[model samples]
Target: MARSINQVAVFGLGKVGELVAILLADAGFKVVGLDAVPRTMLTADGVELETRPLDVTDAAAFRDSLRGVDAVVCCLPFHLNVMIAEAAYDAGVHYFDLTEDVPTTNRVMELSAAQPAAGRTRPTFAPQCGLAPGLIGIVGASLAKQFDEIRSIELKVGALPQNPTGLLGYAVNWSAEGVVNEYLNDCEVLRSGRRQMVPAMTEKERVLIGGIELEAALTSGGLGTMCETYEGRVARLDYKTLRYPGHFRQMHFLFEEMRLRDRRDEVGRMLVDAKPPVNDDIVYLHAAVEGIKAGEPFRENFVRAYLPLEIGGRLWRAISWTTAASAVAVVELVADGRLPGAGFVKQEDIALADLLDTHAGRLFGHTTITQSERA
Candidate 1:
């Protein structure tokens, strides 16, 4: 059995990283928050936290900080995650992150599969532990298991203002780079038992949730490893991002016609400067699976909405809370042996019920499962 994790080193002090440190500390783990820039003392729910100043890009400094730490949770930018992940592997500590970049995740998977040093235990590497790629994949995989002959699996997730007032009908509650990347990259899917890539924002469809009309379209990284996990078993599997009506058309213009997709950095800056983050945000989650169960075709829908939560006496946006909570929950599960301690761990490998039952995951509220008539 793997030794329990008692001390954690969290790299990066961004919004999600801050909350991750706080939540882990609140959960009674010894947490050390690391960042390149100096930061003021942090307190979550009135409990003070221990923070360190260190540069993750510096190999010696990064590996030194991981000394005596059981695990390292990375909240750094998707592009910069590989450095810290490499440091964690060298230090022989378990690693986790909320990255959605395909190339970054692939690199981490490679690191996870590599052989460890002499007599050292191999550590686990779990990535994309946030929102769409995190909880959505967990729920989708769980639902897919209920069927004997899987047909289609659809996933849609969004973080939007409760009362959208912008031209795009959205707010930048999360990383601007992430939004632009998902919007511009090709999405992975399984069509007719074959894995394929489709253009993002091409399959626009209107969906209604709780009486509000929303739009969903193909998006990258949201599917995590589900396409590969269910490739041959499920006939059709795809993931889409939900937005308010007309948002897709506007994005299509900026990315396709205006050629912003070619200039992602400028586009990211524009979004950060324009769509300011909102506190009163809602996270919409929807997962549906269709397959033959007990000789009858069945369809199951798992839907839930998350709002801003008051944690540790602070009001956290729905996106921040949900994303941080998912990462924290996975860390706890790893610490307790509920998950693998070595090698690459995919989001779909986690069971939905196990995730929801965790203390941190309870913020999303209970999942509602509905069954549709036979197709």
Candidate 2:
């Protein structure tokens, strides 16, 4: 039987969490916004959201809050995801999050696997349902299906200010801790049909899209489970974070030379203190798949640039809208029986066409192109 999701609890009141609460409320779900600090009262399309003050670190409080809730959408930091996920599993409610941390996601997977044996009702668990690992992974899988034999699959995504005016050439559009983690961790990729790990910030390359040159480098967690999904199939598969030229060199200097990578807490604080958050930003996405179709070599590229959007009677940054919308859309799919209802779900399992048709996902617009372009 398909479980109907009505009441949803969104843990975390940050930018992305706020939007998630609003979007879900507007979609007619009873939304509860929970955070360590109380959120200012707000409404979406005349729906007043219920706000709760609770510390997610308090396992008892967190589990108690899940009572009577149909689903749990976690927008908390990556490190706190496992705790909330375990609580959600204990409460027997659907779980979703935007975490890009590999180890945290693995923990969620483990919890999802420990559900009661068959014939029992187990809630679904899906992670990394955000920009890079979420939408990009779905698009990459869509393109890969078009090829008779996949050779290489590459994904690049970035959230950058529409107008640059700084030395770093970047603004804090999302979580600074997430940015630091990606910069310092080892990235997973597939080479010659085998899975391998490579250091982040390496393999810097210049890429041109829409007549603009941007730099991309190996980044951690952006590939999500795509490397595992495409293992033993694709000859090469990897994901990189896109940034303006000279950005990688500057990051390399800070993490490698300054030794900030050794002390991530200071690095995160430094980045937050230095780079101010920007609302006028663009979310850039690009995915390319190369393979043989009918014995003829071919390649296809998917590209899009998303700017700030007006939704739920407010303006949201591109990063916030893109990330929040992807998570919400997955929830809708799961609720509507369009996706799996129990156990772990991967972003690649979501179809691009289905995602673009959702109310929240539609905010990304329909500008995606599937052309014979090589990258």
Candidate 3:
């Protein structure tokens, strides 16, 4: 039998964390929002959130915070997730996060695959619940299922200002650490039915959405476990980060020529300082799968441009709301027993239709363009 989830504890009260807590509370769950520093109870969009300070580094205090919680949603940095996940495992509560860090996810997988004591119900460890690794993987996998034999799966995502400025043509609407990590870490991909690790920011290619030109290149952690899941079954599978033209060239010069690769924190700070968060931002998603449908070649594309909108009487950025909504929708599914109560949950394992059906998932609507073609 599946365990019921009612009360949820959300760690990290940053931009994304606060909204996740509010959205969960709005979904009828008892929510406890925690952060390293003190936070006032939030009453927004008709939802009253209970928030408090919590130093997660303190082991006893961290465990104590989970005492009456049925589940935990971690919106903290990637490096901090393994610690929170380990604690959640010990506490026997469901765990979820929005980490795109490879090592962090591997640690979560180990915890989920561990053998629980006799009669102990293993908690669910669902990571990569945000937009790129989360929704993009879901969309790619959903499209792949329609084919008898999949030849390739291509995914690209960009969260950028609707209007561009400067050479970078970007804004720091997300975690600077995350963006830097993706740009620096090695990317896992499936090429010619074999899994391989490739350097990030390579494999540059041109991409067009709604007649707007963009460039894409391999990025770390965007594929999540899709390469492993689709290995030997699919001929090609890769994920990339979408950026405006000439963006990658500038990135190469900054990290390569300027030698800022090892100093990730400094680079992140510099990037954020230059390009802070923007209110008028757009989240572009392009997922394409090519394969045999009914013994004939076919291609399906799920492309959309997500924009900021009013939610709960306030406006939220495209990146913020999309990440928050996707994470909250997965939480809602687990709370309603729509997903497994125990064990590891991969983003690709989720059905796109079911995800869209959730209260928060409805925000992913308004597809700018969807295409089906013959290859």
C-alpha local distance difference test of each model: 0.86, 0.87, 0.90
lDDT of 2 by residue, 1-375 (tens): 544799999999898998898888766678899998896746655656799999776768878899889899999998899888988887788999999899999999998899554554698999999987899999999999888999999999988887876667899878888999998889999999999999998998998877767899999999899988999999999999999889989988898888777898888888778888988888889999998976899888888887888775788888998899999999888888889988999999899889888777777773332234663
Cα lDDT over the full model 2? 0.87
Error of 1 at 203 (Å): 0.8
lDDT score for residue 327 of model 2: 91
- Candidate with top lDDT is 3
Q: Per-residue lDDT for 1-375 in model 1, tens only?
A: 543789999999887899999888877688999998767645566766888899766777778898899999999888889988988888789999998888988899999989998877899899899987888999888988888888899999988999999779988888898899999899999999999999998789998888889999998999888888888888899999999999989988998889777899999889878888888889888888898888898888877787888887788888888899999999888888899978899999999788877777776673332323234
Question: Is candidate 1 or 3 superior in TM-score?
Answer: 3
Clashing pairs in 1: 45-312
Q: Assess the local accuracy of residue 277 in candidate 1 as a C-alpha lDDT between 0 and 100.
A: 87
The C-alpha RMSD in Å for every predicted model, in order, reads 2.1, 2.1, 1.7
Cα distance off (Å), candidate 1, residue 153: 0.5
Give me the runs in candidate 3 sitting further than 4 Å from their true place: 1-3, 41-45, 117-120, 367-375
Tell me the TM-score of model 1: 0.95
